[model samples]
Target chain A: MIAFGILAIVALIGGIGVIVARQPVHSALFLIVNIVALAIFYIILSAEFLAAAQVIVYAGAIMVLFLFVVTLLTAGKDDEEAGEELSGQRITAGVLAILAGGGLAVVGVLYPSQRIQLGLPQNFGNLRGMGDVLWGPDFVYLAAVALMLLTAAVGIMVLNRPPRKKADPEARLKERES
Target chain B: MMLLQVVLLVIKIVLLIAILMGGFAYTMLLERRLLGFFQLRLGPNRVGPGGFLQPIADGLKMVLKEDLMPDGADRFVYRLAPVIALFTALSVDAVIPFGAAIHIFGLTVYLDIANPSIGLLIAFAFSSLGVYGLVLGGWASQNKYSLLGGIRASAQIISYELAMGLAVMGVIMTTGTANLYKIVLYQQHHGWLWLPQIGAFIIYFITGIAETNRTPFDLPEAESELVAGYHTEYSGMRFASYYIAEYINMITVSGIAVTLFFGGWLGPWLPPIIWFFIKVAIFLFVFIWIRATLPRFRYDRLMNFGWKFLLPAALIYFLGTAVFVSGVL
Candidate 1:
């Protein structure tokens, strides 16, 4: 009821926030907010696990990676290296975002979520159900993804580890405890 | 109908502002006291007993202080930066359930402003929005130190937020809900969510500190390097916005932690609000304690930790929880 109004407001604000942020990095961050808000809308619709997964996958995994890569490349200096000129890339992103957002709005107006979802158990699609599906039917696939995640995690660890340096007192204490 | 909604929204905004500003005022005093405790010394007993009114004095001073902007600053964005930072900080509460639903007259009123179905995501979204303040604040200041610091913040938060999100995902896996109240309810029937998901707790806690620009993980505002970092150029209420935002954010983080892990408003003896506040305070103490004890992380190390350590751990935890859930449920 009232919840829909609030989500609409949040989505609108977050959408504007994406545009309002002066930097691409900032804009990217705002998009995280928009996405998360959308995920929360999913939660309100009783798609509980989907909402969490949305934050987990999109906000946690994708956006952070996006921010990290952006920062790593740009943190070396200000973004002026790409030239102060508002290049074609900016125009393209703007048009694409506008078209997508406008198109979505039209869709919403055309069809305002009429099909009622039945038997949406409170915890459906949560880690529990997700696990049921994963182990029952999707175990092999999940295992492969697990292997991939492991490889990626290991790869990142190997890539990002600091050069061996003098251990801190805390590290020494920890080692001693272990 | 629209008018009523507008009025309600305005009231919520006002209440939010009051809570934040009030919390910010007391948080200064609380932090100093906490810092002093960690250092084993009495702190700030000068103005009032135990510096009870120190924040008031501090606010008065900040308000009266020079509102200076460094030269060559981006006039528009520089000024706009604080507002954005402050707004995003305050906006997260639109969905967070402060306490259980309460009845006033005939209306069943929940303390949270928005409480949108996707409440958790709204909070995360606002958190992501927060990085802009740091970036714009730094870029607008025109100081090289500020620029570098701001750039670091841009990089660091964006990087760490990923790990943070994953950590939260682990929680999502367990509770299977995104609405704060539901998350809390999920926590209530089960054991404290943190016990089973220790890895998620650690990752989430560490990255949360980074997200909120707190100590140890606080490379963006590294005092030794950037001379207040992104906030070098801000003063008065503008500066207050950043500090205030940080404290309010501290409350938000603590509140979220309580909801997600500590069983929000479920403890007996006291009312739900009291339990929520107490839990939040405990975490807030942990924040201050960590600040007092730990050394700041080098910038590169912060990124490495996020990517290498926290993210992977969160993923593993999520998978384990999911499997466990599959077996049990």
Candidate 2:
């Protein structure tokens, strides 16, 4: 419980830092802190596989790409100098955030009994258990998620494909003859 | 009794750190001496018998030198980078089982620090995080070359990491566990996984070399182009920190490779820990041998090989392993 409290504070600070840090790279790093803290929370909850996956996927891979892109393109650039392209965006975002938070708070207060129990099964968080869950009854959901990610990747590839050059009629004839 | 256990653990940790530090120093000397021998030249032999004390002199010089922070550099991140590097490097050792459990004061303690179920994944996580140190150090240096080095290092590590992970899938599937200790025990009963999973071993070695940023894949610090790469702007102990991180990473990868494929800590007429170190030493020798034998890969060629060759090969091998493990073969 003490560990939970400390990690909760860390996660909150990291979350605040993500938005407050001026540099994009710094913000990405703060996001990593938040992600790592969340990963530890998974461990405390006895989700060892989930915790490792969380760090590997979020803090390790995704955040590295985020930092790579930010450092590559936004080095020395001041974030505040970029004027908002959408008018009244900040006000709209603030209102939406408050509404989301209020909704979540209401849900928590109304359904406190929905909380998960601390006791878990013996094989609840090992690799074998994860494998069984993914490949057993929940296989379809895993496949669906994987297929969606694949489709998105292929879509990006198509979008980024180089422009095709027009084939000359003479060159076509020569190629056919050859 | 509980307090004694805690104290013993603390002592074990301190001893491990000391051994690793000594290992790092000797490894550096070995690389230098071997590189000289490969080139038909005498290596550093002046400091002590056969250059044994060279690392001590080098350490002193590093500590005594001035620490430089470039103008306009991010001072906070600049200092934080080396700490991150050393921290991640050291932490990876926590999960590596170097020997069988031994009885001490009526307590059965394993030779490693922790024996988590996700031991392999923890090592992977730390290795993946290792890139941040180089990336941040390069970026904080405020030098364009340093930034380029950092970016290159991240891209290289990330690209090879996919194949590396896949390369170990065969062993993981065979053992049906990610626990390092279990993997080694399985190897002891069966033969070393390397003989059966030769392709995976080769892929792992190639990717490991690239991940370590060692020679042949040493483009991260390619002196010909990036001027010492990510650590170009760093000086003194900061520079040594990066150096130590690299060497320690080499040791960690070698340890993992031995644990996974080389029948770790298993041999005739030798202590388990001694056998483990011998295996790791051989891996280190191969690392240095490859350094001496091959030139650094061209940037495009490196990426092309990693993505085009290694990734597909690893995927195919992994699928085959899955089939075999499923009793389809």
Q: Chain A vs. true chain A, TM-score per candidate?
A: 0.51, 0.82
lDDT of model 1 at position B213:
86
Local lDDT at A176 for model 1: 79
Candidate 1 lDDT over residue span A21-53, tens digit each? 656666775787688779879777666567766
Q: Write the per-residue lDDT of candidate 2 for residues B1-329, one digit (tens) a residue.
A: 89987987898889778978999999999999999999999889999999999999999999999999997798888999999999899999989998999887778989998899879998998888999999999888888889999999989988999999999988999998899999999998988999889999999999999999998999988999999999999999999999999999999999999999998898999999999999999999999999999999999999999999999999999999999999987
Q: What is the DockQ of candidate 1?
A: 0.12
> What Cα-based lDDT does every candidate model obtain?
0.78, 0.91
Instruction: TM-score for candidate 2, please give it.
Output: 0.95
Candidate 2 lDDT by residue in tens digits, A19-109:
9998888888899999999989988878889888988888788888888888898666453667778999999999999999999999989
Residue pairs of candidate 2 with colliding backbone atoms: none
Docking quality class, candidate 1 = incorrect
Which candidate leads the pack in DockQ? 2
Best-matching candidate per TM-score: 2
